[model samples]
Target: MTTELERELKQLIIDTLELEDVTPEDIDPDEPLFVEGLGLDSIDALELGLALQKTYGIQLQADSDDTRRHFANLRTLATLVEERRVK
Candidate 1:
């Protein structure tokens, strides 16, 4: 991913997760920041999903089964943005 994309993803993560201790520079592209890394729980996922819809206009259907893949990590989120951008 490009630097701009990475930075945007970092900002999204920080904003969505309400991570007061983390900065854009702290997130690793390939690292998992949910269960095993950042310890985010299911509530965080719900909140992040809502925030993502509002911020990026990428609607993630709550009833869909792709929630895991969509919120997998920073890499997946960034790729989703690149793929779904309105342009």
Candidate 2:
């Protein structure tokens, strides 16, 4: 059901971060997006946040816990986009 959005979010993460070695198929929707799992740093988070905002008209707080939650994984990101994206 949520597979399509998850793939889109995965592609967004890959492109937004310019991760040359990572592909959407390599990402696990349930994996953590940070240090332990995908190993994304804070900078990647910022870039990805911007991409999400530009692509979906989603707003984010740089230091918000809610932002942390929404960035936790591909599924979470897809959920956020689904809930808050403007058209």
Candidate 3:
């Protein structure tokens, strides 16, 4: 069962990245967002981060290890966004 935040994050990722071949339901919450799982690369990460910051009004420290963890997967991303979303 996908949580509301997870569903929202899936859509956000798809829309933000302009992934025409992917849909929200195609994403597994526990799957890694990069490399083998979603096949996202570093550039995708940067783009997604910018979109996340713009959408959630959350400040992300590029050099922080926590930031990497937050971007680990859809579940982690959703948790971070839910905890930090301004509106």
> TM-score of every model?
0.81, 0.90, 0.91
| Ranking, TM-score, top scorer first | 3, 2, 1
Model 3, residue pairs in steric clash: none
lDDT of 1 by residue, 1-87 (tens): 456976987888798778999888778777776796677888988888777777777766566457778677778878877777654
- The candidate with the higher lDDT, 1 or 3, is 3
lDDT of 2: 0.86
Model 2 lDDT per residue over 1-87, tens place: 448778888888888888899977789888899886899998888889889989999977666798899989888889899999995
Q: Give, for candidate 1, the lowest lDDT window spanning 10 residues.
A: 56-65
Q: Candidate 3 lDDT, tens digit per residue, 1-87?
A: 799888888998999889999988899999999887889998998899888889898777667688779989999998888888897
List CA RMSD, all candidates.
2.1, 1.6, 1.2
Q: Which ten residues in a row have the lowest lDDT in candidate 3?
A: 58-67
Which residue segments of model 1 deviate by more than 4 Å?
Answer: 61-65
- Of 1 and 2, the candidate ahead on lDDT is 2
Residue-level lDDT for 65 in candidate 2: 91
